[model samples]
Target: MRNKIKKWMRKVCFPISVTVCLLMIGMTVKAQESTSVKKGIFAGDIDLSGMSEAEARQAVTDYVEGLKETEITLLASGDTEVAVTAGDLGITWANPELVSEALEVGTRGNVIERYKVLKDLEHDNLVYPIQISFNLQMISDILLEKCVQYDVQAVDATLTRENGEFQVVEGKTGYTLDVETSIDKVNKFLTEEWDHTACTIALDVDVTEPRGKAEELAQVKDVLGTFTTSYASSGSNRSQNVSNGANLINGTLLYPGDEFSAYESVAPFTKANGYYMAGSYMNGKVVDSLGGGICQVSTTLYNAVLLAELEVTERFNHSMIVTYVDPSADAAIAEGSKDFKFVNNLEYPVYIEGSTSNKHITFTIYGKETRASDREVRYESKVLEVNQPPADIIYPDPGQPIGYIVYDSAHVGYKAQLWKVVLEGGKEVSRTQVNSSSYKMVPRSATVGTATADPAAYEEIMAAIGTGSVDHVKNVIAILTAQAQAPVESPEIGDE
Candidate 1:
């Protein structure tokens, strides 16, 4: 019985030992083959079977490089499209370790387990999907640089006047790229959603709707207020400036809560902008400057705006008194300093119509009238303080002859206020102060000449200027004129 048991043990133990030895040898072979990826393995569609780690890496890199030129189109409104490439977004292989991961596929487990894995690969591929990386900031930068050009800017609806009729101009919609969100979308598509082939992706875009539709602007038909100012006394150049400024401001449409800038509407003050040198008040004196008479246009618009009951956002009084409008009623705009701005506070849009005819500039504010027909409004100029001008001012002009003289009349200074009176059904209901102003007292100024060929006559004119009297200067000028006109002795000529 002992011998028979020994024989059975030997038979079992020998087979077990042989099997263990064969398993150890098989594992050793798999370890040796670990330098290369297992058979039937793939990185995406590129076959990596029996390929070394370096070769597999190179293959994957080549695949990524080949995909670098894939076309990606960015689209925007107005049929705007921009084409870009994957390389522009800084694409690269994300996981290089996956190549090594692929190499260890059948070599990692015990001999039987490794055999089972290799057997499984015979029927089903052992695919280590190719993962990629993208520079997110690079993607954003590309969209900003290349794709931003396709963005459309929203345009506001406006109005135009033709043949004394108001015409409506339509607005356009705008589209802009959403860069950050678009980057995320592109990254996700490339990493998980994309099939790694030539494909198109629509980027994230934002839509903007324009303001002031035609239906909204059609309500601006009733005339809310109107004002006119005369420029008959202005010279040809000054009158042209007035007309030019009025034309620039004509047919302007202002929606509710919109502010109008008088200076910005007609600016640059250059000859290119249709302005000419004309007289304007400066340093208590009249000086010639470009766009000099444009203040009259703003003043006219201001009165009309006041009558329309619009909100005044910014306003400035002129440095000196102006003859076109009463004190405390004028609006002035200067370069870099003063501006006249008003807001359309009503519920509907307002259309400004400006025109110049027969030496008069007129501004009319048209909008939907909400006030009762029985309501009446009027503006009154009130004088608070009167200041008399000082003695006449004299300036010497070296460019003119001794008898040449020019004078400017004095202007009296005043502290004045404008009042807005509202009446309902022929009864006064409200009286409010609209604005207040202070005018400087400018003395009568004279430019007198002292230039002469005769030193004696020049000295005489200087002496008259020292006396500070125009009569003295006139007397000296008369004497010089009489002397110059006196006939020379004729006896020499007769003898000849």
Candidate 2:
């Protein structure tokens, strides 16, 4: 019974093994036969030795028409799919005889030879279309190459203008390519679409300038040409020595707390300053110098500033009183030494306009008219204390003949203190102690000498010895003469 079972097993197992070996041999043979297959599009040749160039090309075109409807697809698993639509796929066959005829007849190749015309006809017009259809993956690769090559190209588009200037804009320039499109590949891929296209690229024209938030603050207000001044004169001069005119206008208007300076605004008189040199007060006498005639302009401007009730920023006095104005009313200015300055105490902008003619000089203050007005100034003087004149004695010497000298000090004068006060609403709002002045009591010295020593010379000697003022000698004489004539009236009252 065991031998019989073993025999049955050998028969079944041996036949089964032999059948499996045969099937394996068949599969290996099939793989070997397909290994040499080169799958791609195919182009055919047409004989057209007798045909013209146009006729040859036309025959190629007619042949390519047959392959237009062909479609090809690629699969991810090394499998392929193909569909041919007779209406769409095209085919073309090259005329080899025409190429051979040209090679034989021509010494040098023509345009046809340069382009490899016959081969190109089959390759570009016929085989290229067939390859793109039958070899779906090759179609995708070729389209990708076209897209990279034609990513940027020149074309035309419309331009529109809106604002200040024109410009140009960049646009997307690219070609479309097919990647994967097959029933078998579509099942395995995330997306399957063969979109092959020749694209048109262009540049967008921008016809406008940017204009949104670009403005300056200076353009909003019109305050360019407003200004002011105080007085007018020729070149810089002291007192009446300055003849007034446009070239001599002095004293600038202050914009609120603005500071003022004589030399800063008024240019110095020189040949470059367009002025004729004039005499200036020096040592109580006139001396010729550039800019010597401009001080009268400063004094006039000072008076106007006082009348306007502006704040005095800086002030100084002249060495001697000017004849054009009283001693108490004069104002002086010297570059880098003394200055006459005033600030606008008023609220609005002030413009100063001044002109001088032959007889008088005038300065006009211009601004927005308001209810505020200038304060009126008045001064009154009274004697505070008086000192008697000193006794004069003449000295005689042989070397220096008979001569006289006078002694005068501030102590030998009438001492007086003055006050300046401001009033508003009929009441004094402020008061200031202005000055403690002393008018000296002059002495008279009579000299009896040789005729060679003139009395004038003796008088000058006395003036030089004392205060160098004739007014002092004249005051003493007047006091003595008045006392001799009217013993009751005092010289102080006469002065008042």
Candidate 3:
């Protein structure tokens, strides 16, 4: 029985073990090969198997850059010529990560599967789809400019008299081409696998009827909510900013679902737009900047929208508290980074009437009344926690006499919650939380004089500091000035 078993093992198990050993060795070689791309891998016309990742990326970028010079001719009037540059068509590389794919040629999947893929690459050349994308909107805009100039819209015959002037005009169907079809054709051409440096394409001729006159203005009725804020303390430039921003938002109509963006409406705050240099907080210090005080207009508008029950989409608090509005009630706006937005929630369209007069900014929201006319809406701020600012920072001033001290403003930090309250006939109905606000405190600053000065003034100033009251430093300066201006003895002239 032992001899029979040994014979069976020699015949079957020996061959199976040898086959398994050779397979393991093959897999080991294939795993090392994964560090580099397989032999038959290529990205477009360029072989990427031996090239490094960075080299492959540069090659792909150069290929796309080469496409930028491709001349695309637009055929017009069936024969006339208009040449379009690749850039004008917004042709640019879309999938830049294709280079990474080439470097990872045989590295994907499990061990055995990866080995199978690497083995297959020895004979088979795998090609991926080359992707080129263009900005559809940019293409549309470019085509629109050309179409408006080269083609005319269809017009129907009409007779009209305006201010005792009568006119009769003949109408004819006009040949027009739309940007939609042009955009589609351009996209298809851009996605073509091979780079055709020079291509010819033509816009199709389509017919359309045109409208005659402008639409009438839609009037808004009913006052939804109104709010007014006083900015009397703000100086001329800042005050003007508030008024300018308010005027920009005036008479603006928003449909039921329209979102109002305060920043978008009142941007480009250049001196040309009547914005003036005013002090604003930047990097923890007050610095002069344009459109410094227009945030007051946005804050007032925000409160008005909230009162009108509009859906608040976005709102932000200032880094520090402002005196115009209470904590958690103010809405702050900075161009591009921060914005205040709200959506009209009423069934009918809403109109904004904003105006500023006598240092006061007001926003009145008018819409179809869904809530009761007597409904009272207001916000109450709830303080959560008080935070202590960091230790005071000291700055040395050589221009001031030694021991002179000047104090900068101190900031207090707090966390507060804003609640929106709804009342009916002076009775509370519903109270909902609007937002939680956190005010960051900027540490108080002191500028200490370090310059050498008269001995009398210096001694008195030092005494004031040692006693814990630097406020007397200025008084010492006053006394020292009086002594210097006193009458001098005649003997001093003889000694000199």
For every model shown, what is its TM-score relative to the native structure?
Answer: 0.90, 0.33, 0.56
Winner on lDDT (1 vs 3):
1
1 or 3, greater by TM-score: 1
In angstroms, give how far residue 378 of model 3 lies from its true place. Answer: 1.9
Against the unseen true structure, what C-alpha lDDT does each candidate score? 0.87, 0.43, 0.74
lDDT of 3 by residue, 1-496 (tens): 9999999989999899988976895667565664455577777776777777777677777877788888888755333467877877777777778777877766767666767777787778876555778778877887776644667667644333235332334455666665677678877866763365787777665765532222211224567889999988888988988889998888676756779899988888898887888877666666779988878989999989887889999999888777887789888888767899999776666778888988999998876676776788888989898777666666656688664676656577878889999899999999999999888788777676756656665666555445433345456656666776799877445554
Q: Sort every candidate by lDDT, greatest first.
A: 1, 3, 2
TM-score leader: 1
**Candidate 1 positional error at 202, Å:** 2.0
Give the per-residue lDDT digits (tens) of candidate 1, residues 435-468: 9899888888788987889998888888888887
> If candidate 1 were superposed on the true structure by all CA atoms, what would the RMSD be?
3.0
True-vs-predicted CA distance for residue 453, candidate 3, Å = 4.2
Clashing pairs in 1: none
Clashing pairs for model 3 are: none
